[model samples]
Target: MIEALAPVFAGPLDFARHWLELAEAPEPLPRRPIALSTLLEEEVQRPLMARHEARYPGGDRRAALSMWTQYYCAQYLLSHLGAWLLLGRMLPFRPDDIAVLVLEDGTPDGFRLPHLGAVAEGPVDLEPLIREHLAPLFQSLQRHHRIAPRVLWTNAAVRVSAALNLARQQPDVPPLRLLEAEALLAKPCWRDGSPNPLHGTQSRVEVEGEMVLRRRVCCLRYMLPGIAGCGATCPIKEGQSAKPLPLLKSA
Candidate 1:
C-alpha cells in the first residue's frame, strides 16, 4: 500500500528537501527516521511549548495554549508523516487510513451514551484531511498569539465567492478584498535565512499577444505585533520589496 501511494505523495519529498535545505543540512540526507523524530520532539515541540509558556504566563489561557500546541504538533506530525512516506518507511498502516478513535459510551469498564455515533472517518485526500483536523490546532495557535487565520483566495472563483460571502456575515471580521488591495507580492524565501537560488525568477505569460511578466510568489504566516490576527508577509523580491497583501486574495 505504501508503495502504491508513493506517486500520490511525491510532493512530500520536495517539501522535505526544501526544509532540509533551509535547515542548512547536507544532501543525500540521513537515513535514521528516529533521529528526525527526536529532532522534532526536542527542537520543535519542546521549544514551542516553552515559547507558549513565556508568552502566556500562569496558564490562564488554557484553551488558547491547547490550540497552539495542537497546531504545531499537527504540522510536525504531518511533515514527519510526509517525509516517512517519501522515505518508504515500512509501517503497518498508512497514516491517513487510521481512523480516529472516539469513545461512544464508556466508563472504566464500559458505559453507553445514547446519542453518539462511531469514530470520525478520515478524508480520502490526505492533505485536506490533515488541514481540516488540524484547523482547531492552528486556531489555538492564533488565539495564543492574538491572531486569526486569513481566508486565502485561490484562482478558483467559486471558492473565492464563497469565502467572500462568508466573510460578509461576520461584521467584526474584515471584508473580502483583492490580494492586490494589500499591494502584496509573494516571493520565496528560505526560512532559515539562507539564500534561495530561485529568488526573483520571472515567468512570462502571454495575454492578448502581449507578454506579461509575473514572478512566483510564496505566502507564509507569522506573528506580528499590532496585528489582530496572524500577519502574513508576502515577500516579493526578498526583503527588497516588503508589501502587505490580503491574506485571502486570489493566488
Candidate 2:
C-alpha cells in the first residue's frame, strides 16, 4: 500500500514517513489494532490506560491522558499535516479508515491507513481533517476523561505548527503551498465559521541564533509524576501552573 503513496511521501514530506503506515499486510504489525473511534469506550480505554499507567505508576489520570494526547497528535499530525502542506493531498484521515497501533506499553506507535486517500489538484483546506478527524476524537477523549477540548486541540496545533515550521525551512517546497500553510494559521474560523481551535496554538520565537516554537497552551505533562514538561516551548511560566480540566465543551 505504501507504493501507492510513494509520490506523497517523496521529497521533504518523507520526514513524517514513520508517523503513518501503509502496509501491504497486517500480519507484520508490531502492536495490536484499535479502531481510533473505539477509544471512546470505557472498556477499550480502561485496559489501554492500565498499560499506560503501568509504564509510569502514580501518574494522575488526567495528566496521563494529556500525555497520551501529545504523543498521538505529534506522531499522527506530522504525517497528516506534512502531506497537506507539502503536496496538495489528503491522506486517509477519517477515523473510520484509520487504526491506532498500540504498543505493549499502550502508547500509540502510529496510524495505519487503508490507502493514500487522494491528492487534490489544487489547494486543499484543513476543514476535512479538523471536522472529520480531530473534532470527533477530541470529543471522545473529553467525554471519557473530562479534559478540555482545547488541550487536545492545542496538542494537535503544536504538531501542525511544527509541520509548518518544517515546511517553511524546506528549500524545495512550492510557493503556493507555503501560502496555503500561512492561510491555515491565519484563518480564525473553519469553513462553517466556527472558531478554529488551532488558530493560535503556537508561534515562532527567536532563541539564540535560531527560531524555535513556543506553545500557547501547556499539554499538562507537568502534572505527571517524574515527567518533564515541554521546557522552552511550554506556555506555563514559573510558579503559575494548574491541572487541566474541561473549561469548555468540545466543538
Candidate 3:
C-alpha cells in the first residue's frame, strides 16, 4: 500500500530508480503498532510532566502538562491521521490499521511527536476512526490530566483544524481527494469568519490563492509564555462570543 502511495508522497520514490537499488531495498521500513493509551502515557504525558517540572521549577506543573498534552495530541492526530482526515474519502482505512511511529524521544512536543506512520491494507470507516482511535486518545488524555471532557473536546477541535491546515502545507503529499475539505470549505460558515458549526473548530478554509483556516476557539498557546505569538483570531485578548454562535444554518 505504502509503495503505491510512494508515487504521491515521496518525490524520490515517485521517480524511476536504478534497477540494482530497487532490487536491494525492496521492502519498506518496519512499523510497530502501539495502543493509543500506551502511546499517551509513555510518550506524551510522562515526558511533558517531567520536562515542565524541570524547566519551569514551579507553578501548576500538572496543569501546564495537561495543557501541553491537549496541544500535542492534536498534532499527533494531524500528522498520523492525515491519511484518514485528508485522504480517507479516497484511500479508505481503519483505526486498527493505524500505528504511531515508535520514536527514541519520550516527549509530545512538536519536535518529538510520534507521527501516524503507517496503515495496513484494508477498508476504512470514519465512525470507527473517531470511536476507536480519536475518542480513546482523548479519553486517555482527560483521564491522565483529570481535566473535563468539555475542555479537552473544545481544545481538540483546534488541534484537528490545525492538522487539516498543516496537511495543506505540502499540498496532496498523500494523494488525498480532500472531498471533505471541499465540502466543508464550501459551507456558508466562514463567509463571515466564524467557527459556528465547529467541525474541528474550522470556520473557514480557502482553496485557491493562499489557503487559510480561521479557528473559532483559541488553543491557549498564548498562556504558555515564549512559544509563538497568539494569532489575531485568538480569543484570549478581547474575549470571543462563540457562546451564542453568531449564526447557524448559514453554518
Please give each candidate's TM-score. 0.25, 0.82, 0.50
TM-score of 1: 0.25
Q: lDDT per prediction?
A: 0.29, 0.72, 0.43
lDDT of 2 by residue, 27-71 (tens): 445677677878767788878877786655555677788788878
Instruction: Report the number of backbone clashes for model 2.
Output: 0
Alpha-carbon runs more than 4 Å astray in model 1: 9-132, 151-251
- Tell me the number of clashing residue pairs for each predicted model: 10, 0, 2
Better of 2 and 3 by TM-score: 2
Model 1, range 1-251, lDDT digits (tens) per residue?
12332432343332322221111222222221222222223343344444444443232233334334333333333333332222222222222222221111100111111121222222122233223333433444344444333311111111222223333343442222222111112224334454322234334556567765442332221222111222122223431233322333212
Best prediction by lDDT: 2
RMSD in angstroms, all models? 19.0, 6.3, 11.9
lDDT of 3 by residue, 86-133 (tens): 444323223344334333332332222123234544444333344455
**Location of the lowest summed lDDT over 10 successive residues in candidate 1:** 102-111
Clashing pairs for model 3 are 80-116, 93-124
